[model samples]
Each structure stands twice: as structure tokens, then as C-alpha cells.
Target: MDGSSPAAAAVIERVLAFLDSKTVAACKTVNRTWYTLATIQSARNIDCHILQLSLRIAHYKRKGLLKSARSLTVDVSFVDGYLSPAAYERRVRDAAAMLQSSLMPVSHLKLHASSAHAALTDGEIHHGTTAIGLLTRALPSLASLDLSDCPAPLLTASRGECVASLGRLCRLKWLSLGSNDMSSATALRRMVRANVRTLVKLDGRGDVTDPTMQLLMDAPQLRQLDASGSGISDDCLLALVRKRGASLRELILSDCVRLTRHSIAQLTPKLLPQLASLDLYNVPVTTDAYQSLFNAQTHWPYLRDLKLKAAIHHASSRQESRATDDILESIGRNCPRLVSLRLFGCYGSTDSGLSAVLGNLGYLRELVVMHHPVDPLIDEEHSSSEAGGSQSGSSNTPTAAAPAANGPSSSLSSDADVWAGIPSLPSNGLPQHSSSARRAVLPLPSTAPSSPRPADAASGASSRQRIFTSGALRNGVRSQRFNLLNLDMTYDSECAAHLAKLSHLHTLCGRMITRHAKSLIEAQFPKCRMMVWNID
Candidate 1:
């Protein structure tokens, strides 16, 4: 058989595919071609736990083949005594020696260890010293270095020397240090200052303060920043936004509680234009402030994902009502490209506010309004009735609605079932009526028992008092609580019925009986693709 023929080439390809599944040693003896292909595939990506890699290093050294590795990942987790102080030092030194001697041209080096590792503790200076020495010597050509979940306190405590060592990683473009115990912001500042020019991503959770953020802003090359669960305040966020980092594409500020309307007003207009995604979890921003930010128009045109988490705060009086209204209105008119919106705890937003915002964003694909006050009122009422009926004599009846020291409702239930029986109105049925467009007026289930007499009411006047005062039984009453409560129940049933008519909606998630209502809708409108109920 001629070796250069097409048939021979096809045979070689088939043999190579089979060899890909076998181990290097098994493939080596198959043929010279198999040996070359197996070795190349094996050298392309090397991932080893610290212990395994240490053992492998010793074996490779013994075999005089350590220099063949091109990519290496060392994960030093606290498993099977491998992360003990002595073992950690030994592994680090061995890995470093191997890298220095044979892997100097390594392009990708990932150093991942759990926070519990002994060598990652500030108190154990010897372990940190050895680990830092190893990292400094082993990672010269690293294009990606992820020191994620390494004990930050230990790294910070060894600040001066560790920072100097980290500076030696001149080619590092991606870095993540999320969820560490780095108490001193100064250490992080030093690290960023030393390597900002080459760094493209920084995950400095719990250690990024305003000053450190300022230093990062100076790094013109930074494109992605994850400050989630960090102690960063609005001041730090403002500083970050104000600084022109043209390369930035994603910014995650989840759980940064100090962000307020004032900070959002200052930052949104500046950062929105450059950012492709922004996560503002539990950040307090008034409607007017959001409107002002959206008014800039230039900011959100390029935004693909804008998450406004818990966008509302409890207002003290009616004076702030207009501000909240303006915010919802602005969001609806602006942000047309939003794909995901999670308003999990924004109590100030009602169905009207949500409709205002969501109605305009035709591109929304993933929406999570769980636990927020934005659920249909009918759904909320059905939930309350079910809960109240279940625990009329027990203390748990109102447990779901109890407010904190500050007055805010606890959860929002879906009222989709309330509209279960309503006739299918045309899509354009409520073009003039904003609420009517999505409105469903389902018939109340015959199964719903009549409203039970207030258990505590003893007389006619007392019964009226009991009915009104029942709002207090559940939680602190809003000014229009009773009226809202009744409407919530009514609307919930109505909406559930109407939802059955929407044949185009693929998925719908809501509360208790809403699921039943969704099934009924699916039965009526078989074209409706998916229905999920009782989803919070």
C-alpha cells in the first residue's frame, strides 16, 4: 500500500481518532504518528491538584521530561492533608522548581486554592513566604493567572514581599481574587498599582475600597471588573464610573448597599455608554434619578444586560411618590435592549411601576421579580387568603406578611389565577389602557369558599372593624392596604383567566392557584409554549 495515498491518509485519521481516547503510554507504542499526536494533545492543557502535580513533577523529573509541559494549573485545595503547612510549602517549592527549570515558557498558569489552605493564612508566615517565592519564580510568562479563593488575609499580611513578587507576573492579563479574607485595601491597591497596565480583568471582592478602585481606574486596559459582595460604597462606584476606562465592558456591583440615588445619578450616565452589562443589586435609586440617567439616551443604546436589583427603597411619606413614578417611566422609555431584569426586593414598585418599565423593553427574555411588591395584586390577595385560612387560629397566619422594624411587606405573590376565566381579549384590546394590554380577568374559582367572618369580630360594627383591622393582623398596613388587598385578590383571579388567552407567551410563572390558572390557559391556548406557576 502506498503511504501517501488518500486511502492511507483516511486510515491514519481513523487511527488518530481512536488514539485520542487512549492514555499517552498506550498511544506511544501504537505507531510513530500516534506517538506524536498523543504527546501534542497531552502537552496542550495540564491541570493538576497540588498533590497530584507534585507527584507528577517528581515522576517527570525522574524521567527527564519536565520541560515538555506547555500549560499548567495548580489547585491547592484542603483535601486529604495535602494543604497542611508543611505539605503546602513542599508542593509550592517543587512546582516552582519544575516551572523555573522546564516550564519557563508556560503561557497559561492558574493557581487556585481554597480559603482554608494552611499556606494561605496570614498567621502562618512561613507557608505564605514559601508560596509567594514559588509563584514569583514560576509564573513569568503567564498570560492568565487566576489566584481565586486563595486566602486574602495571608497574602495581604505578606504584603510588601508578595506585592513585589506579583509585580513580576508581567504578562498576566486575567486575575480573579474573589471571596478572600483580604482586610487591608492597601495590599490590593499595591497589587493593582504594580500590574494594572497589563491586567484586563480584576475580581477584588471584599478588598476593593474607594482608593484602591481609583488605582484600578488608572489602569486604562481594564475591561471587566467584578466587585460583587465587596464593601465598596457609592463613593468608590462613583470614582470608578467617573474615570474614563474606555475598555470596560462588564461591571458587577451586586450587594454594594451604599449605592444611592445620588451615586447612580453621578455614575449611570458616565458608565452606561461604555458598559455592556451592569449589575446594581440592592442599590437605591429613585425613579427621577433613573429617568435622568436614561434621558442621556446615549448611555443604554449599547447596553445589552442591565440588572436593576431592588431598585426601590421604603419611602417615609407621600412626598417621594412622584420620584418613584418617574423612575419607572424613564426605564420604560429608555433601556430597550435589556435581556435580564431582577427587581427582587423593590417594595416601592407596584404592578403599574413594573408595567411602565417592562412594557417598553420588548427584548426582555429573563425576568426575576421574586419577593418584590410588583406581583399582581390579585395574586398577593389569593396568597394572603390561603395563608390566613390555613392559620386563622394559629400565630403563623400573618407570619408571611410581618414587616421588619421598618414597615415593608415581606413577599409578593402572583395574582395570575384571578383572571383565569376572562375571555381572550385581542392583543390590541387595551392599546389605550396600559393595564388592560396585559390584563386578564379570570373568573373566581367556584372552589374559593366565601370570605370567612373575621375570627375575632363579635358584632356588626366589630365585624367591620375586624375586616379593616385584619390588615394589621398580617403586618403594618399601608395607607390603602384594605382596598389594595381586596383588589389584589380580585385581580389575581382575573389575570390568570386572561393569561390563558395569550397564545404567543412561551413561559409564565406565578403563585399558588396561578399554576392551575396557567394550565387552564395552556389548555385554551395550546400555542402558549410554557406555563410555570407559584414561582417567586
Candidate 2:
């Protein structure tokens, strides 16, 4: 349909709304009317640093595209292409000049360092400050600014012009300076106090201490605060929450290790009534903290997304495992509106405990359950002892109980607990098992050699070498799917069959799905995509 006609234009608008940016860009070439509409929409969000930003801006300006641009991302990391620090600074200055010359009424500007860029050194930090000053001076209407992962120090700008530009940014309601070295709270306090009344979202995930937090005491309009890894304790956190609690909607305190049970227990629903998303990953909390935060009496009805993944391979593994159990149970009792739950290193949690929480949160769309490290992997001496112990008990290890590969029953678990339902093959083409005792000989990694270095021997006999499995995938979301059924490390034929029964499932990611299990999964769910990686 051509965009010239009113009815056809309305239909095309609706269709364009549903399509992604690339599709919309492609649709622009269909006709003149479409071209005009697409150009306007495309210029709304511009990635100025994706290619030669100066050339792109010049081309867009020639085509009258720069005027429509509203949200611009000025990535300064590309300056790394230059060999010397002088070359990098010159390029940054040139970029700033080009941006200054452009007339793109950009309201949202994100000056970020690319992920590949290393942490900013003192020299680079100075250059970064100059670049920020240049860009902010050019964009007078800037309302939202994200300097996240930028190498600049938190408190002081390298140049006075940079600090003056920040103070002049009165329209900035959203400011994100995550990962900056804010060693001087004095400098941060001055800048924040200038725009404290209008700032809504403040992300200070840097070297923020109690002094840094105290700067936020007057920011009553703040709605979202991410002070992750800021090295702040309960006293500072509680103080910030007390001042900004009524308006704060999202709080991310990930990796704040100094926060103990005494401080965490005080995080009642009353403190953050409007809180919607809470992330406490790697924050060590005791059982009492979990109980107090998510008890029957405590309730955060608006809370939807919660991530409490523990920092595995730590000294407090046992305590953290127990804390996980208590937290999961409390989630079942309190957080009824929970949409996503991630529990890493929850080794002590049983199938029953997980099932209980799942049953309660029916609207849950994402569940990440990475159980604690296997018993053998965590302790070197224990692994060595187990290796020796297994050799001694090789005769007693149930080798005979392992079913024959040729037998049809061998492919299917005899136990009912292995599968949820069905006596034989279900419509989904999966066999249901009733028992948990189904046995299989796992292909474990070989043990380390007896002779090892002194360091290796002291750490553990097994520390000399790491066990390499045939297949294992690195952690992270590998792909996007319409229906995400289950993502876990429990890879086996029985678990594959059980997962196959999930009728709505479209994607399954695991460390290792054996060839047999992969084939079974394919047979049961023809449309389902399986991503398996070998374990290390």
C-alpha cells in the first residue's frame, strides 16, 4: 500500500510500528511517500559512531536528515584507531567540532566507550573530559545523558570547561556515570546538587563510598539508582533509600559485598514501596537477611524482576547455599507478581523447593537456576580423595545397572519422577519416567597426574590440570526465541524428554545435550532449536 492515501497511510503506519528498524529502513525504498516517512522515523535514533560518524552526519545533513535526529549516541572509543595519545585527542576534538557544527536537536545523548576499550588511564580520562565538554556544549537541548563506562573520573573533570558544561546541563533529568572512578565525592556533590532537583535516574556504579551516597540525600525526584560495586555499606544504602525511597522504582545493588545481614534485613517493603526491579547479585547475605526481606509480613506487590545470583566459588559457599533456599521459599510466599527469577549457586535447593516457587509465580517468563559447583570441581583435595576413593570402589560402582544401548528401555527412564506424566510415549513423542534411580555411566574428565608442582600439591593434587569435557557452552544468552521454555545445565536424555513435553517451548540452551538426547529432542519438538556447548 502506498503512503499517499490516508487509509493506506494509516495501515502502513500500523505495519511499520510492528516491524523492526531494519525492516522499516528497507520499506523506505518502496516509494516516494514511504521514503519520506521512513527517513523521518530513521533519523529519530542515530548511532553516530557506528561508521565514519563525520561522513554519516555530513551525508545526513545534505539529505536534511540531521534536523530530525533526536536521540544520538556519540561513541568516542573509535579514537583508539590512532596510535599516539596526541592523535587520539586530535580525533576526539575533530569529532566534537563536527558534532558542534551539526543541527540535530538531540535530547538524549549517550557518550560511551565501546566494550572492547580498556579502562581509562589518566591521559585518556583528560581526553574523555574534553570530548564530553565539546558534545554537551553543542547539544543545548540535551535532557538525558549516559556517560556509562566512560573513562572519566567521577568527581573532577579534567578541564574546568567540562565541569561548567555539566553545571549548565539543567535540563538533564537522567544521568548515568556508571563505572567512573568517583574517588572525590566533593566534586560529585557539587555537580549533583546543581541538578539534584530535576535528576530522575542516577547511576553511580563507581568507587562511591559513604560520602558519595550522602550527595544523593537531597535528590527526592530520583526514580532509579544503580550504585553497584560502589563499596558502600548498609548505613549509606539505608540513608539513600530513606531519602529517595518514595520515588525510586528500580534499584540495582549488584556485587556490593560489604552489605551484611544487619543492613540487608532492614530492606523491608516499607522502605521501597514503589520498587519494581531489584538486583542483588554477588551480595553476600545471611539466612536472616533473606527471611526478613521476603517474609510473609513483608510485601513488594510491584516487584517484578529479582536477581540474587551468588558469587560462586567463594569461601562462604555453605552459608550462601542455605541463604538461597530461604530466599526461594520466601519468594514463593511474598513476591506473587514476580515475572523473572534468577538464582545462581543455589546448590542446596531441591526439585521440590524449585517446583514450589514455580507453582506460585504462574506469570514467570524467565527462570535461571545455576546450581552450586559440583562437589568435585570446588575442592582440589576433596576431588583427589574422591578420585582415589572411586578407584577403590570401582567394583561396587553400579556398572551392571547401566542399561544396554541397544535396549529400547535404555533410552527411556524407568522411574516416573524422571518424566511428569504418560506411561509410555506421549503425544509429544516423549517417554515418561516414574523413578529417580535411572542410572547412566557419565564420561567424567580424567584425574590429574600423581606427580605435580609444590603449588599444585598445596592447592590440591587436581590443581595441576583442569578437566576438559567434549561439549560445554560459555555462560550468556546465545540466541533470542519467541517462547523460552527452560535454560539450565542439567543435560541428559531423560531431562531432554521432560523438556520436549513443554508444548510452548521453542528454545533450549544447556552445557551438554548428548547426541541421543539431541535426536530425541528433535523428534519430539520439530520446531524447537537446541543449543549445546561442551563443558570445560
lDDT of 1 by residue, 1-536 (tens): 22256677466545545444446557667666656555655655567765576567677567555566656776644454546666666666776676576653567666655554444434344455456546665667667766665566545654435556775666667766676655646656766777778888888766677777878877878888888777677776776767754567888877676667777766564554667787765556555555666563534655666655443344432223233434655665666666655444333444455556545666655554433212222234544774576554445333222332234421222121122212121122222323321222122222224434334312111111101111211221112101001112222344445433332444443322444555565577565433222221
Q: How many residue pairs clash in each candidate?
A: 30, 14
Instruction: State the lDDT of candidate 2 residue by residue for 333-402, as single tens digits.
Output: 6887777676654544544456556556656666655442222223346446646855555445433322
lDDT of 2: 0.61
Q: Could you tell me how far off, in angstroms, the CA of residue 198 lies in candidate 2 after the best superposition?
A: 1.6
lDDT of each: 0.51, 0.61
Task: For model 1, give the 10-residue run with minimal summed lDDT.
Answer: 477-486
Q: Which candidate is the best by lDDT?
A: 2
